[model samples]
Each structure stands twice: as C-alpha cells, then as structure tokens.
Target: MQHALTKVGPDYDVVVLGAGAGGMSAAIFAAMEGARVLLVERTEYLGGTTSYSAATTWIPLTRHAQAMGADDSRDKVSGFLDRAVGNHSSKSVRDAFVAAGTGVVDALEDKTDVKFRARPFHPDYLYELEGATSFGRALEPLPFDASALGKDLHLIRPPIPEFTILGGLMVDRDDIAHLMRIGKSAKSTAYSARLIGHYYLDKIRQGRGTRLVMGNALIGRMLLAARKLGVTILTETEALAFTTGPDGVTGVTLRQKDTERQIHVTGGLILASGGFARHPTMRADKLPQPLPEFSPSAPGHTGTLHDLAFTAGAYHGDTAAQPCFWAPVSHRKRADGSMAVFPHFVFDRSKPGIISVGRDGRRFVNESTSYHLFVSAMYAANKDGSHVPTYLIADAAALKKYGMGMIRPGGANIAPYLADGYLTEAATLDELAGKLGIDAAGLNDSVARMNAYARSGTDADFARGTTVYEKANGDPTHGPNPTLGPLETAPYYAVKLWPGDIGSAIGLVGDENAQLLRRDGSAIPGLYACGNDLQSIMGGVYPGPGITVGPAIVFGAIAARHAARRAVAARKGDAA
Candidate 1:
C-alpha cells in the first residue's frame, strides 16, 4: 500500500502540518515574516474540527479586555490559573500563553483577515473562582462572507450541518434569538424574513449560502489571509514521516495523491494536527469505560501526527487529570445511514424545563453547569455503570418551547426520532421512566420536587441558577429561576446521553516556546506543536469558553516566531 519516492521538491523555510486554526495561524505568521512556507493537510478541506466549533477564544488580560473597560491584568490571570489549574500545568507555559495571546490577536488583525470582538457578557465557567470575570475575557470571530473565497470556498471545511438550519443557512446568536421568536413578534418576523431572503439569494448563485458564522467564519477569514500572504497550501497531502538529520528534523516525507515525495524544510515543522479523539487504541488507553463513539471533531483527526511526533522523540504529556475535554452528546442515524451527533453545550440543558437523570431517576448535578463539568459529574456517578447512559428528560411543554438534544423546539417533527429510537416518549412520568428502564417511583418523586422548585423559582437540590455561569446559560426571558422549570406537563420525553469529547488534552509535551520536548525534558529541535496536538495549558480543567482555541492561536504564533528566528540563525551560521 506504500508508494515509492518519485521526486524531491525544493526546500522551504517552514513546514506546517494540518490546516486547522492553529496550523493556519503558524503558516500565516511564518510567511508574513518572509519565510517560504508549505502548509499540508491530510484532508480535502482545511479548518479541521475548528469548523465545527463556536470559535470563541478565551484569553485573559488581553488588550481587547482592557479596551472594553474590563478590570483584568496578567497578575490576576496568573492568580486565577494558580487556583483553577494549580501545579498540574507548567507555570512557564501558562505565563508564555498569557504574554503572547493578546499580542497574537493584535498581530493577526493587523496583518491578516482575522478579526475578533470581545464578548462583554460571557462569564468564565467558574465565575466564582478568584480572578474570574463576568465579561471581556472571551473573543469571537466576526462573521465572514464565504463569497470572498470564490471557488476556493470548496477548499475550506464547512460547519456541521447540525449547527445550521434550512440546509446551509448560517445563524448567529442574534439570528437564533430572532428565529426562536419568529412567530411571536413582528420584529422577529422581519429579522427572520431578512435572514432567509439573504440566504436564498446567496444560494441561488453559489449553490450554498455564503454567510459563514462562528468557527466557520474564523476559518474562512484565516484561509483567505493565508492565500493572500502567498502561503503554499497542499490539501490531500499526507505526511508519512519526518526526515531528520544530526541537527534535528530536516524535512518530511509527504504522499501527494499516488506519488510520494521528500520536501526539505530549513526553518522548522509545526504540528497542529487535530488530536486523537478518533484513534481507537488511544481512546481505549486514555478514556474511562464505554469509550466515546461520537465526537464533534473532524474524522480526519486520527492522531497520525501524534504517532509521527512520537517517532521523532516527542513524548505525550500524561500527567493531566483528564485526557480529553468532555461533552454529553446524543446520536441519531441520518437518512444517509451516517450518524449525526449533537453536543449539548449551550442550547437546551440550561433552558427552563429540562433535567438530566441517572438510571435511578434522580438528578445528579445541576443541569446548567458547563458541558465539561456535566460529563465529569457523569463520570463521578458511573461507579456501577448505572450512569453510563443518562437521560435528558423534558416535558411536552419544554419540548414545544425549547427542544431537547437533536429535537428542535416549537413542535418539531418527533415522529421520525421516536420511530428511529433516538427519542422515547410517554404520556406520563412513570411511563417515561419505565420506557427508559428507570424506577418509576423515583422519577415521579423527582418530578414532584422539580415542580415545587419551578414554582418557587429556586433549585434547592443543586443550586442550578444561583451561579453566574449557570445564569449565563439560562434563558433570560424566563422569570425567577431561568434554569428551573417544572416538568408538570404530560407527554414526557427522553434522549439517551453518552460521555463525549471535544478534543484531546494529552498531546506532545512542549516548552513555552512551542518546541516539542523529549522524555528527558530536552527540546526536539525543529519540531513544534500547538492546538490539541500540544498538552493543554489548562491541565484538563475547563476554565472558560475559548481555552483550547486561545492557547492554540497564541502558541502557533510563538512557534512561527521561534522558527523564523532559528532559520535566520541557521542561515547566518552557513554564511560564516
């Protein structure tokens, strides 16, 4: 199955593997520094799993936060990390990230098409923690029009279909709000009409709507900037192995289509391949029982880069408390027979009238907690496999007002879901519990308790809405306790939930400069890592919204800068 080497390409100043936000940022930064760069992606499309994300980056004490009048500082962020992540993470790595994150954002905005706006209202996941803020730590990409990519649009990875509506119409937070109230208010109806009209108009000419939002927007803008910067992008080109010399990694063996070639790289190699979430053996070794089958990550994330880096003497960081970021996901078989998974992050669980229950039919944790914390609770309660497949139970009224899991709100067609076994429906709480194989008596009692809390606007069992983080995810329109609502209506429904991962936390060990480190703590020269390919600075703790992406972009810039400087030094040494 292997192809023989047929040709040797010209050497480049830098080589970047993968085409996600991190890799693209590295390539763009290197090229901007006047280094000839080659960016290779194994998949046909760029962006990788980031396209499926919300693309919000959480970097504290940034100039953006200061600009927004938020009282944040580097010392404060350091204090927060000390308490939130503790000694599990490297102080040097955290310091480097804090120093470089905001500068990277500013540099990209100045030199590339990338742009970001501070989210003044998004709170830290642990808002009560020391140094946590209620606003301005998170930055999201501004929406971008895919029409700017022209035919190149096909090269960028599209967002997940589950994140979109009407086949391919992209919607923002405002658009979602307007959509949810389309029939209830005239202003919302006008907003919907305008959005739909634009979508259709774009679809008429492009065959797909072109207004990309969220992570898609971030990737679209970066790709456009990469092209403009003259960075050479090679898609469907797989890096088979590294070509090392006495000094360090010198090049890579790449398989482009049917032909294999050796491409020399004088600067360095940056590994930003999406992590090992889809790797079978890796998952078995890293995760708890009943390994996750559904992930929001791209299928191209097979951990090939992790293996390749290991072969080059890079060691995976194994000291983190958790191996990967967790999320509760529900799966359904599409018409095409492929499975569709939806991560219950922000939309449904925190909204009024929904509660997650264990096999014994009792609420285990606050339903409005962060997705990572929610799954952590599931893991804590999985001592006897009783919580392996928890259920997200909601009443008919909640279903009609705010859908659960893959089901859309406002009476979306549930017949297909029920028929396909993705959903279970019953006219009464006891009946639903029986269908879900839970104790009917326990469920009835839990529902009765929830009804009392809903009426009183308080959650005594778990304090769901008391925290700033909980209230942030809760439906604002709902009065009293936005996160607490009664399950009094008949026709209860349930969706089975499983532990899922958004990305891997254990990856190549690297220093603050983004240089991969060997087992003995020695740097593997010419090899760098960022994104999920590098051990997370958060040390497996979910601190906030953009922890993964913020560090990814920052370290990407760090790697590029280091490589550029090293390349210059090498050239000077040769001249001497």
Candidate 2:
C-alpha cells in the first residue's frame, strides 16, 4: 500500500526530525558550525510539547547561577543527582550536561534572539537533598514578541488554550498574579490593563497576540533564530523511514503532503522528536499499571521517530522506576469536541484549604508535594483502582482564594464548568463526597483532621509542610503552615484528577556524545537522539523544574557539535 518516492530532495549535511526546543537547538547549533541543516516537523507549526510548558531550563552549576552568587559546582550537582537519581543514573550524561549547558545557553543568546534569565529563587523539587540549591539553577526564557518572526509567526505553535486566557492572550507567572488580582489592587489593575492593551493591539494588527511568554516565547525565539540562520524548515513533512547505505544512515523517506519523497543527508540524522507521550501502545507497555489518558504533549508525539530508530537498530533505554513525568490533570470538553486538559502544577493543590483524596476520601500524600511526586503517590495508591481518579477537594473559600484546576479564583463564575460536568459542587463536604462517589464519613473525618492540622500548624498524617520544597510552593499569606489550612468552608468543590504525563521518561539509549546505541551498546553511526527521545538523565526522577528540558538543550548542542564534526571529517576523508 506504500507509494514509491517520486523524487529526491536536495541533500543536507544534517537533518533534524521534530522542531521542538531540542530539535531546533540541534539545527541551529549545526548550522552555526557551518553545516547545512534541514529541520523537519510533522505538524504544520514548529515547537512540540515544549511550546506548552513553562520553558524553564534546569542546568546545574551554570554561569547564571554563578552570576547570582550561587556557589553550585559540578561536585555539588553530582552529589545532588546521586541522591535524587539513585543507582540507575547516567553519570557521564550528567557530567556532559553540566559541562556544555552554559555554553549552549550562551551560544543561543549570543548568536540568536533566544535570551534567558535566571530564576534565582526557583527551588529544586527535592530541595532537602544533599547539594540541592534553593536558588539560581533554573533559567526561564524571556518574553518575546512574535512580531519579530513577521510572516512566520503563524508557524510557531501557540500555547495550550487551557494555559492562555481570553482566547489567545498569553501570560507569564508574574502576569498570572496580576490577572488574579486585577480588580482588587491598583497596581494589578494597571498590569492587567497593559497586558490586555498589548494583546488587543497585536490582535488587531496580526490577528494574534505578538507578546509570547513561557514556552511559547522559547519556541518563538528558536523559530526566529532558525529562520535567521537560513535553516530549511519543512513543515507538514514526516519521516517515514531511514534509507541506509554500507556506511550508515544515508537519508530518510519523507511523506510531504500527498507525495512521498526521499531527502538525503550526508552528515547525520538527529532525532529530537518529543518522545512517545501520545503513543497509546507505547504508554500501555512502558508505564506502570493503568496508562495515562491525558498528556500536554503535541499530537505529533506518537513515537514515530522511536519506531523508525528501533527498526534501524536503536535500542530503547531500560525501564526506570518511574517511566514518565507525572501530573494530575482535569479535562473539559471543548466546543470542537476535543478535550482541554489543565495540568494542576500550581495555583491550587498546595494552597491552603485544599487536599487531594482517594476514593476512600482519605489523604494519601502531602498536597504540597511536586506534581510528579503527587501523581507518584496516586500511582502507588491506585493498586486496586481506588485512587485512579482522585478528587482534589476544596471548600468555597479555597476556591474563591486560590481556585481549583481550570476554575478561576476570587469567586469567578463556575456555572459553565458545573454545567459541562468538569466540576462537582455541593453544599456540604459529605454531600460533595457522595456526589463524587467517595466515602462520606471518611471525607468528614479527613477534613476534621485537616482542620486540626490547620489550627495546630502541623500535618500529623503525611507531614505536608515539613519540607522546604513543599513550603516553597505554598501560600505565604496563609498563617503558620501555609500548605496546611482547613477545608472548613462550604459549599465544597471537587475536581476529578487523572494521571497524566508531561513527557516520557523512557527513550532511546544513547551515549554521552548523544549518539544512539544498539542492543550491544555500540553507537549507531550518523544517528543521534536528544530531548525526550533520549533516556532522561535523571532516570525518571523529576528533581527540579526544568530537568526534562535542561538536558534536552544540552544534549542537543552536543549532538550537533558531534554531528558537525563527523561531517567535517567525512568531507576531509572524501577529499583525501
């Protein structure tokens, strides 16, 4: 049923599959080194799952941290990784990331418009771990104006609609605080006005807002850099299979629109496709127990490159204790029949007066834990499906103050959500428990215990606010233990939480040079894998905010440098 490729496309020195942060990094880096590069994406738009993320890059012992007076070193990072990642960690990869990461960041900032600033106060997930720092390791992309991309603005993937407000208006972490307090304070009102004014002005001119923040800004900057570097970006083009010669992989068979074409690559092939988050079979096989139904990854993240690589003799990494980064998500049916998933990372769970409960209506984990740890507890509690769909129960006061899931704070109208069945609300905790199919008496007892903790400022059950990590994400305005307030006010509200992944932790086995390895641990020539396509350096541990993306950009630069060198050597060999 396969059509023969009708034509041969022009050759390039290097070809990168997927136009995500990692892929874009590879393409730009290779092109910077004087390699003709082709960056191909199956989706019409650039940026993969990264376009929907916070876009924080967690590179340990970076110059940014040094500039911020953080006394982090490779030795300290190694100690932290040892404690966090345990025995299965890749030391060489970790070392490579630390060594090359700052250089890559600097390169991107110097050569392109992809600027970054240090989040000086961002805490690592396991802040109590040895060598973990409370500041200056994570780097966030600076907000970018999409107008810089000009006509190509439409090609950069937009942020998730669930993450945006007012259709297409984008906001950052600081801006969210402003919007939440828009009417309450003059400063907030001014911030909101300025944000909306800019949004409307951009909308009028280009039909979409130009001010991009977070992941959208990161991707937009990279796309602008790629275009500036004259990298050939092929959208809506999918790599079907690799064509090999006696030497190694020579080219790839591509499906472009209705036609199948062969595009040759002389240097190397870099696979930075955003892993298998959307691949059902892969998810079922790799993940523990019941597979996750919701993910924030792009639809193009269907393990296409993984499959192709496997067929070409690349070996998948050994399964980790946790095979994917976890999060709790609530979904709402959109007008177009698709679901809009909102990942509950911040803005609700760790706030005062909210607690997640299992079907038995008992707290199973510290509500202030990182989203990954929270879902890990969910997985552990899901032995008999009792915690498959845990409920994040909060009272009206909490809902009004901090919100829950997709619900806006400060008593925003929630009738639409209730009508759509995205949330369940009742006049009493027992009534809400009954509506959510949770044990009513158990729910009442748990709330009573929570209230006791709220008054005493101590979580006796799970020790919720015991750690600096937990307290960092908590409400500072709340008295005593900010993460341990009582869910005493009614009516009670509940959002159904299902297990979701940010990205796959399992990926192709690759060496320190970012070269894909075979079953026998031999490097596959001319093949490289970075980003989620390569096994996570943390061995599935979500140690910090940008763990997934930090290694991605670092290894992407490494892969490009290695590939470009190989290409140069090949050219010299040919000439000799």
Candidate 3:
C-alpha cells in the first residue's frame, strides 16, 4: 500500500458511511490521495452484501482482461449497454462508470494490496445481444489469507451460512470443482484433501477459516488497505443526521457505541450505505406488488442514509426499469428458529433435469437465464399473484446431483429437508403435481416436452440452452444439451421459489463525478454517494457478474478523486 497517507484524522477530509464495497473503496481512494479519512460502519462487520457475494467485479478494459486476451473495447461495451440499459438510466453517468472502471481497478492494484484476476471464460449475462463476448469483462478478486488481517479478522462479515460448508470453510470456484471430483481423479482428490486439511488447521488456529475466498477476500484486502492507510474506522456507529455549513455538508452526527457525537469534515460526506432493501417504508413504496416476504441482501442497508440524504437535498432516481434487482429465492426455517433465505443464483435451476413452472404448471421463461431475469419472469407471470411462489421441480437423481434451493448436492439424506417441509417429495409426477397444487395434465405435458427437448438437444418451448451464459452455467457433461434433460426419475422433488430482492436498484441520483444531485439538477455540494446508496447505473438491468461491485468501486473512486482535489484546494485557500 505505497503512497497511501498515514494521516490521522480528528477533522477528516473525507468521511464515508457504510463499510461495504463502495464506502470502503471511497475511503481508501481518498486516503491514498493523502486525505485524512474516517470510515464509519454502523455494523461491527466491514463488508455488507459484498462480503456475502462472489466478488466477481464486472469491469471492462482492465489490464487483467487485456492480459487474458479479452476482445473488448469501450465502444463495443457502450453499444451493448445502450441496448441493454436503454433510457432506463442516465447515459452520461453510466458512461462515467464505464470510463473510470479500468482506472479504478488499476489504482487499487498499483497503490494497495487489493488485487483482481479476470477469468478466461465469463459471459455477459445477456449473451444473445450484439457486442457480447463469452470471455473477459468479469474480474474476480484473488483469494486472500484472512490471517493477514490479524486481529481485525473478525471485523469481516461471515459468509452466508448456506454458502459455506465443513462447519464454516469458505471455498472458491477451483475448490468447489475439486471437491466435486473427489475420488474420481487422483489430482482432484489430493487437492480436495489439502484444502480440507487447511480448513481444519485454520479452524484450530482461528475461530473461522483463515483462507478467505470470494467476497470475504475482497473485503479483507480493502480492510487491510484501509488499515495501512491509517483511515480511522469506528464500528457499531450509527449516523443520525448531517450537519452542514453554508458551503455544504460540514460534518455528521453519529452515535458511536453508547456515546453520541459530531465529527468535523473538511471535504465531503460519502454515502454507500447499501440500500433500502430492509427499510419498511421504502420497501412498501419501491418494491413490486404482492411485496416479497424475503430478501437475501445484507442487513446493514436499512435506507437510513437515504432518508438522511433527503434532508441534504438529495433525491432518488425514478427512471429505473425496476426498483430492485431480484432473484428467485427459497427459504427454510433453521433449528435456531431463524429462517434461511437462499437466492437461487445459478447452482440448480440451470442444471439437467429441472424445470421451474408457475402455479398453472407451465414454463414461463428460460430456465437457464440470469437470476434477475428469472425473477423478473416470475413477476411478469404472476401479475395477479397466482403464478408466484412458483415451483422448481426436480427428480431424485437431479436433486442428488445438483440440489434445489436450500438442498445440498450429492446428499442422499433429504430426510431433514422433507421433515421440515422445505422440500416436497413424491413418487409419481401426478402425485408431485397434486402435492404442489399444479395442474396434473399441464405438468405431465411440460415434462414430456422437456424430455423431447433433451433427446433433440433443442428447447422448443423456452430455448433453455441457446445462449452462451445458459450453456456456461449448465452441466457440460450432460446429454445433447447441457441445460436440458428429462425429469422422469422416480420420487420427484419440489421447492417453492419466491421473488427475493438481492439489492436495491433505485437510489439517490448523482452526477458523473459521484456528487449527489438536487431536485432542480444542481450538485449538492459536499455530498457524494456510491454503491446502492447511489442509483444503479444499469437501471435495474443485471448485465453481467459483479455489476454491482464494479460500479461501487468506480463511483467510490470518482467521489474520492473529487473530494481529495477539493481538500487540496481548501488547504491552499487556508494557507493564503
């Protein structure tokens, strides 16, 4: 973390609320510019939903992509986004994110320990569209050793319980691949053994596994960078209101622990506090009809900052195609009396021998499409709410191999899941339809058509495996088509899928510089927002993996760059 400032801050030049991807990046970028910074998190943990994410940063034109031979350009991406996002968002603001994305990644890698590697094969979610490619564009954060965080390790939010295994071991893509090939290949066996061995050793030395992967690793790297930069971080701190001067926001009123105090700010107050996913008022107003009962987003984003920002003359963007990014989710009650809401983000739905149908027992959308599209399809099909709580039907063989929703793969004992009513099992297709209240004839016909598609390698009804992304997520070893298969095995299984918002898409409107905008279109001086706190540049369109985190880093950097420049000018003014 060279060239980063070691300045302590009583009167900080930049103060960022929220320790998620955007806020942490803003704090680090400003600190690297020698700006005294204060990073405040209401929760004790450093990462929000980002820590629970796969940390696939969707930034194009980065050196990682170039080195990996990614055939992409700014114009090509612009064209694709223009079609995909259209007039749903501010084109200029979206352009700003695209332009600054590569530079933001470069700055973090060059000036700090934060590092990212682009995968050789990652498709844009909408692969059928023109200007789309099968590889590059999506970058993933390198796995980090959490021990490097030392005593601050616990400050990182734990991964979703359903996502981790072996009592808390977080695994990467490679690790998962190896684990799946256990006993089938000698090399895979050895790799899996070593990985499991390390996890146990980590558990012995640390309460949790020290080998951080995915979102945890991304957050760990940033947390480490913030520490090295000497950015002041106060956790369990609640932001009450913004204290402003004639020029702009001058400070923030905070309740840290048991004490309430106001801190001075010399540059700006940055808002990256997740979104309104958990806010009751915002949910009622912004979310879709029937109002989803579950959400997989991090608990920290309660829209407190958005409300506070309203007092600072900030307004929310209303042009988005949708208010929140959605996912088809399934939930089950845990032994602890808490419900576990799991977003079905590409594990089972696309795999062989599975079909998602509305209550009418007919397929509604491409089963292998992106999670956002899947949920959007749910909403479209359930205009009257009857089609919602759709059923994901899978046979016993598929359930054992791919696992549906909260079910684990390769597990023979579905007794617990069945007993808890998380899964409904039946020995016959007609019996399964009856259990799920599906039309037996429609369900039977749909399954027969799917079986026909499996044999012919073509999805006549829904075009399941036609796109690059669909095939990429499907089981490659399967029949004529990877994502198409017959659901004829005995003892069928079903899980109820509900539309769950993964993150808020609508947020405070901001300029290209990441500065908040007023109702009359003037920039609100001294206030900036990024992450979900800022309106989604995609306008509720889930373009590719890491779309959220990618923009979070970019706009955070934009805000930091402007804030740091302002701080330098202010110092010159004071000196003169």
Per-residue lDDT of model 2, residues 1-576, tens digit only? 111234334687889998888998999999999998888888888889888888899977666788899988878888888788876657787777887887898788888998888876888889879898888888999999888788788888888887788999998889988887878999999989999998999999998999999988999998888888878888888899998767778789888889877787878999988897677688778887777888767777889888889877997777466888899999989999988988999678888899999999999998888999999999999988999899999898999988888887776889998998888999998789878889998899999999999999999899888777788888888879989888877899999999889987889988899998888878888999889999888898888899888888889989998998888888899899
What lDDT tens digits, residue by residue, belong to model 3 across residues 42-158? Answer: 887889999999988888889988898888899999888998999999999989988998889989999998999877789999998898877778989899987888778988999
Question: What RMSD value applies to candidate 1?
Answer: 2.4
Tens digits of lDDT, candidate 1, 291-370: 77778778777888888888889988877778899899999888888888889998888888889999999999999999
Pairs that clash in candidate 3: none
Instruction: Name the weakest run of 10 consecutive residues (lDDT summed) in model 1.
Output: 1-10
Rank candidates, lDDT, best first: 3, 1, 2
Ranking of candidates on TM-score, top first: 3, 2, 1
Per-candidate RMSD, Å:
2.4, 2.6, 2.5
lDDT of 1 at 441: 82
- Candidate 3 residue 28 C-alpha distance from true site, Å: 0.7
Q: Which number leads on lDDT?
A: 3
Which scores better on lDDT, 1 or 3? 3
Q: After superposition, how far is residue 576 of candidate 1 from its true place, in Å?
A: 2.8
lDDT of 1 at 372: 91
